[model samples]
Target: MKKFNFLGFRFLFRVERENRDDVQVYSDTYQLKDRMVYFLVFLMIISLSSQLGNIFQRNKYIDKDIIKENIYAPRDVKYKDVLKREAIIKDIVEESEKKYIYLPEIGKKYSRGLNEFYDEILQIKEKKIKNFDYDFFEENYKLKIAPEIVDGVLDLSKREINSQRKDLMEILDKVYSHGIREGETFITTMAGKDFKDKELSNIEFKVLDIFTFPNYVYDRERTKFEIKKRVDGIEDQYTTVKAGELVLKKGELLDKEKIQVLNALGIYSFAETVLRFSVTGIYLITVSVIAYNIVTTKFKKELSNKNIYGATFLVFALLFFIFRFFGKDYLYLIPFETGFFLLQILVNSAYAFYFGIIALIYITPMINYDMVYFVITLLTILFATRFLGSVKTRVQFINLGIQLAIVKLIIYFSITFLTFGVSETVLLDSTKIILAGIFSGVLTLAIVPYLERSFNILSSFKLLELGDLSNPLLRDLSVKTPGTFYHSMMVAAVSEAAAEAIGADPIFTRVASYYHDIGKMKRPKFYVENQEGGENPHDKISPFLSALVILAHTKDGFEMAKKYKVPREIRDIMLEHHGTTFLAYFYNKAKSLDENVREDDFRYSGPKPKTKESAIIMLADSIEAAVRSIEHKTYNNIEEMIRKIIFNKLEDGQLKDADLTFKDIETIIKVFTKTIIGIHHVRIKYPGQEKESEENKTDEN
Candidate 1:
């Protein structure tokens, strides 16, 4: 057989025992069962993911529809209003003005042309030419100045001409300063308000217009660039719909904008509907796979137990339906922490934490993935698991609830205020969260007993209750078989110590030790412990009968435990504590009487201890009895007897099935030795003890 061990869990490939083919067959059957469990878990996750995703999907709506009732936001929803943003951008772009550039060089060039035209007029006048060709000057200058205006300028004296030229230049400077666009007639350019303040004759205005070419040229690329910049500067329009805020009023028209708000609140459109399902399905599958890997690698022991595994998935399913049906409004009302509490009690705390986190992750999307809720609830679960470790009483559950409530309040306010600031809604939600924390504790207390009974789970609280000496069974043992009761108490003490030393369950070991010999109460006088100076009952019977009487206690204790509703684990301890070891004293006595007497007849009908706690109880019970029987009360004597008893049990093959390692055995031996030494330690003499002893000896002499 090949074996693999990971984190204290062993996986065996095959069994190689001779004449035990049934063992291999059982292994194969278990493997099949394990695989089937994995398949069923996968199927359940897929089915739940599909169903729950659809359950929370929003109802469809179209544009321009009239809503008969009001639609409110299920959760605090903040989304970029795509329709509104686009509309705003479009309006801004359309309202923006076209841009233009001013060319001062155009104005300067036209001014120089006017100055040269004046110089030509002076030359025409100085030449005293009759019938000067004014049309030629107009064509050459590309100006359509009136012939009379040019002739009037030419006939002016030199002083008047300089004054006219200065006035024309001033008019041109004023016109170009304001800029003239291309394709405007000179009449229209001079008819504007800028020229209204100027006092210029028609000829002068004409001269200015002829020189005022379009100084401002339209820049196509610059205009587009400026318009784009203005559009980019417009911020994205975002709409934040608070939880429980109205999206649309009754009798209101559901326009595109309102439909968008609904969609942002998870009221999906056809495309969003498809997307939600696909994304949800993929997320669930991925998280489930990761969770599966974590469990198989870190919690192999929990995975082997069908009940724990099944119950875990059942809790997951319950939480999913609860969150889906209640929606986000009542998310805090559900006692999510109760599931973690139950798991911590029923399973180990580590497994509870892992399962709780995974379940939280699985259900977060149902609540719109509210990160504050997730983080605070996750902290509460963590606190519950860590604080409620090994519950000894129901009161601890109540205390845990109060602590968790306080924790939730502090965390809720801290996170909420930091993220969303203070609000009436936040304060109200915090109160509900506190209530949820308290309710979880109460619910856990209510549910744990039923789960423990249904699953046959032996929780620490159950163990503590069973371990109480006031219980009817223990009371009966104390009254009817005082000697056995005392011996059981000593065994419990040593067993508990050994269990703690070996990292086994001390509470379970101690509790099992208390009930391991309860059957001795049935016939107290038949055993030597309860004989109390009376004649030995076994002396009157044959060795076979004596052995039978002695071995009957294991079966008797087992039946009594079952009748009293003792947990299966404790009852198993009662039956398997003695194992198949022979009654050595009786067997030896019987062999002397009959040379052919069989050892099997004197041995216990045996299924040996199958757990570390049970095995520790067995060792503690034997060592306690053996040490008490020693007449010499010395440290070496007690230590030597303890080692001998453990070695005897080991040599007899009684612990082969106990699943105890050599290291655990060594630790158990050391603990048992120390405990027994304390129980049998020599007491210091009191101040008058020696004198009292001497006086008593003198009186006797």
Candidate 2:
């Protein structure tokens, strides 16, 4: 079991060696399980950070708290003042007048009942029923006419009773026509006022009182309808807050009025809090998912999950805290392009552009989704990613900062002029935006080195630095093994040209080639190139031993590279440049001695060239050595040699895993042929050299 720590996180790997001769090492299933656990842990951290941001945003304001500082609105918001609107509606409803409807049928109904009672009395009298039960009249007419009244009515003559009934009916009609209202004593007053002039007996008055009924009824539905109409007619009470408008003054008390205004602005409500949390969670998860898909699909090899997740986590956390403390007004001060620049330098430019856009979108909500800010930041990120490609020195970053500031000012002024017509406010904001761009580049320059070290990333800046010949490892190679160093220089030149032709990283290829043979420094004379016409070290040793020594160099070189802390890409090139191609000289020599010798024993342990640059280096290394060994240096001979070497490498399956197309291989071949021919061009012999060569040849004959 081996444990490795990266960026404060520990990873455990269980190594299993099946055979010592094989180059590949196997790991147990724990590696996959550990990766999943790491992923889950990262997800949990992201979720928790998002929730913390949500909590901060949701509880940023409180009711009745003293305003410590002025708070400006994030955007223009027109909110209905719920408390004020309700009070207005209440006042309007209360002031609304009540309504009533008249019922004319009440007068007719009372007259009909009185006429029936009279007819019943007449019938009783017509039957000549003396001493008959007066209760019959009460029961039949549904009335409580007294016995005395009944007797009075019966004792009267027919003409007198008819006249009295007619008089009472006229009085009742007059009283009923004047609409009586329930819960009012106007009935008695009205009857007395109209009948005082008439000579009405007590019985007639009592009968008129009994027959009277209230006809005016309150219209509850209609009254409610009118009140509702009035309330609806009242305009809603709305309070508007413009963007950047101060909601509260420093040291002022947040009274009920201010609290109500804040509530209207969505500052203090349970539903609003929940909505903010929901939006934050959804946005974080969606962005994380999209980033995961992009990184895994496009940048899996160039970027590690740790670097991606770690960088994203920091950016998200930084944004959340900035918004939480300073609010959206200061959002432009954040150097968002710092992250983009780091990604561009550490990863691919295209990846930086894509992830930068995602980050810009995520922060747009903080600025209240202002498209102006979004567009400005988007163009800034585009400029940063595009123009800041392959930063070679710290001075370039400073220049980039100045350039970005200028570009940002130009873009801001252009957009503001077209849309907002160049106001004073726009001019002021342009200053802030320009500073943001400059600050981003400065911040990127400051943080890139730390990030490179922390994440162990090999950016182009580091590549250029590593390519310097004054580097300690390269210096050591030159001092210890000058022949191998010279050979490496030639290989680097050819490989760099081929890489440029194929759109690969020429600097990385050149740097990797410079350090590829650092292992030969361990025993310089054992290799033929460094012998310098001295006795061959391989003459005393068996061919198998020589093959072992040669094969051991790739592994030794990988270890030396690790000791010197070279980048992983360079270390990989060191190990893969030789691939598994057979050492034909050693293998043939061993086979001539013993037919039982195995071909695999003479091959270098290799995982094959897995990248276009590594494959080009492999071809260049072989082609350079083969051409240098040629006695007759001709263009056709060099071309034939390069073609044959590439064909042999292809047939040997050394490039099976390399990401090279057939067209790329052809281009590489032309580049190598031309470079090799230039390096080994035919030279005109001087007179002293020609006489020396002829005398030497004559002595030899």
Candidate 3:
């Protein structure tokens, strides 16, 4: 019996696996369904329900006049706009043109310019008005104010006399006018009778100029915008079907209007729900099974069952509902990249891109957008992801987002240009789409670090961090055991070359190689690398004891690596650098001393190299130590030594776990030979030197 929680419910299950003999294999823990599986089911159920809402609801909207013919309403429905039209209010909206409302400052500037030019005339006029300067006015212009003449001066009524004086004024009326220009053409347009005040004589009124510079003004750019906004926008234009209204007859042909009313009523029947949900469930299960097959078969090491399901949940959660809802309507604005970005970050680039294609293809029938857009987006994502092969940095990832945005913008513009031309509305939507692409990339940067921490996955950025040689364990090895450090460096160089030749991750291989032999550092003097002053510690101890001391490094290195918080991949390399091969020299020495000595007791405890990097490190470690030990070096001799090391590892089953091919091994051997030759090349002796050396040797004999 097994207990499991699924979708917030606990259940007891009886599950059994059988062998060839039909005996039950215990798999209670293995068979417990993970929550991520439940999440996928939950996600798909909701997405399917959302889709059914559309599928059951009718939307075949086509307007037709039935005034002449006998066409009845379809089953009760509301009117809806099925067509995705650019709001024709575009015609009403004044083309995003700006009109500035000239502030009070504009009028002030106009008035100030007029005042600056006619300042003396205005000032004299002001003084003349205050002092009643009839003498100066008469001398300058041969004009005089008709202030009721001298007769009214004796019986002066202040209000009447002042009105008469102002009515005869020429300067005040000529200098400033509200919204009137300075020329006669504009003055004639204004009402001339208004300037003819009854308080003054006809001569005073005639002498006065009718026009003054217009002061009230506004900016056309600003005012035009205000007018356009007030003029047009999206209006409430939908038609609704009242309850119990006869939408259409059953036998009537389904046109656009009848379909819309049925859609609005959410015309769901029990039979339709069952059929649609059943179809959706089958679809969900099919794709899930294929994804599972790929995950188990191809990405077992890189991803766990939980990781695969979790990533699927993320993709569907980002995609399914959005497509089921908005994708049916505004499919052009659908975020194709949200799930794609998360997939590439949570999973690998290749997995993310391929899986994204499968998901997009599956949903193409449901969305309203053109298949061309969907295909273009899928292909673009594949290119962007594949282009970023293995090496990735923050900046490169950001630039990738920019590239996606640029590509999306170009594609969208091309489509729009072909279909509708570059209108204001199309350009506006294009900006939104291109921004979504860019946001996909930027959001990746924000989301990845969290997933990396949660899953403890090794991203390219994390790999780069581990590739640095200044880590604590490596620094200690370099200082306390310099010879071992040199050996490790040589191993790293060779492993990196071999890795690159074989299409493995060279950075990871080189990094793992640097610390593959860290266990040996624990017993530095026992091995050849760290012995000081020509003294050997292993010589003083029994060969059996020496083997035990040497074998303890793998165990010790694992503990130290755990303490230093070394990444799991590097730690794995350390543990598997040497397989369970017998320490031969010590085992043979022990056997010669005591014939009862056992080989098993002298073997190194190992799980063997489980990945390509570890396997390459294993080979490089053995070959570097062997070639470094040789005092006499030649290309032919070095080649034989390397071939022996490789064949022995192959025969002993140490290479069984890694994914290296025969072709890969052969390529590695060639690269290793080239690298070793470069490292250990010897200068050829000249003929005279060789002869002289031989003659000296003969004389000494």
The lDDT leader among the candidates is 1
Report the C-alpha lDDT of model 1 over 148-191, residue by residue, as the tens digit. 77776766789988998987887777777767886665577777
Q: Write the per-residue lDDT of candidate 2 for residues 1-701, one digit (tens) a residue.
A: 89999999999988785463323222323333344345534543544353354445534555666776777887655555777878888887778766768889877987887786677677777885445454754565455767777777778888887888788788777777766765444346564465567777777767666667667777889989988877777665666677889888888877777877776555654556667667766775676667556655665544334564465556546655565455455655666667777777777688788767766765555555567668877887777776766566877876787677777778778876765464556666677767876787678778777777776678888898899999999999998899999999999999999999999989899999998889898889998789999998899999999998989898899999899888788999989999998989999999999999988898888989999999999999998888988887766677888899899999999999998999999999899988887777655465578679889999999
Residue 619 in candidate 2 has what lDDT? 92
TM-score of each: 0.74, 0.62, 0.60
| lDDT tens readout by residue for model 3, 1-701 | 99999999999988887443323223322222344356545655664665566445433233452322333333222233543223445444546444322244433443343233233333434454333445644554444545453333324355544554444333334433334432333335236536443444443333333213233343665656665565544443445454456656544665554545544554334455456567766886787667556645565544444555555566576677777766644565665776776666555677777667666755654552245567668767767776656536777776776777788778778865665555665676677777776776677778776666665556666666666678777888898889999999999899999999999989889878887777777778777778756789877899988888988888888888778767677887877898777689998899999999877898778888888888999999899999987776766677789999999999999999998999999999989988998877654455577678789999999
Clashing pairs in 1: none
Cα deviation at 224, candidate 1, in Å, is 15
Give the candidate number with the greatest TM-score: 1
Indicate whether candidate 2 or candidate 3 has the larger lDDT.
2
lDDT of each: 0.78, 0.75, 0.65
